[model samples]
Target: MERLVNQDASERNAVEGKFGEGKRKYGLDLIRARLQETSETVIALQFLIMNLGRKLRVLFFKFLQNTILSFDN
Candidate 1:
């Protein structure tokens, strides 16, 4: 169905966007590992770093929000 196709495309776009971000921002586009294992490790580590960065950002903002709220009490 057309709806299913649209959904698939949307999902694909989201995934591709993440890949682009990883490559552009995290140096994933410059991977030069020749071995399969090394390549996989590099990819995994890149994603792990990206995920950790996002988590830290979220935690930091939440802490900032709470601190500001406490000041108003």
Candidate 2:
């Protein structure tokens, strides 16, 4: 099912593509731009995940300390 949909989409795009010498160049330019944007987004997400993981670890340790201290009281 997914393959059928993808094939149909490609066929439609092929028909609409500009039939000129610059068409291939334009497509490659768009592809390059999209790849750069995707890479930057992935890097940003990894940074955010690392920060969140650190925060969660600190919180968990604090929680354990509080529980143990309260028990001593």
Highest lDDT against the true fold, candidate: 1
After superposing candidate 2, which stretches have Cα over 4 Å from the reference? 1-34
CA lDDT, every model vs. true structure: 0.97, 0.64
lDDT for each residue of candidate 1 in 6-35, tens digit (9 for 90 to 100): 999999999999999998999998999999
- Per-prediction TM-score, please? 0.95, 0.53
Candidate 2 lDDT (Cα, 0 to 1): 0.64
Model 1, residue 31: C-alpha shift (Å): 0.7
The most accurate candidate by TM-score is: 1
Which 10 residues in a row give candidate 2 its minimum summed lDDT? 20-29
Q: List clashing residue pairs in candidate 2.
A: none
Q: At residue 28, what lDDT does model 1 achieve?
A: 93
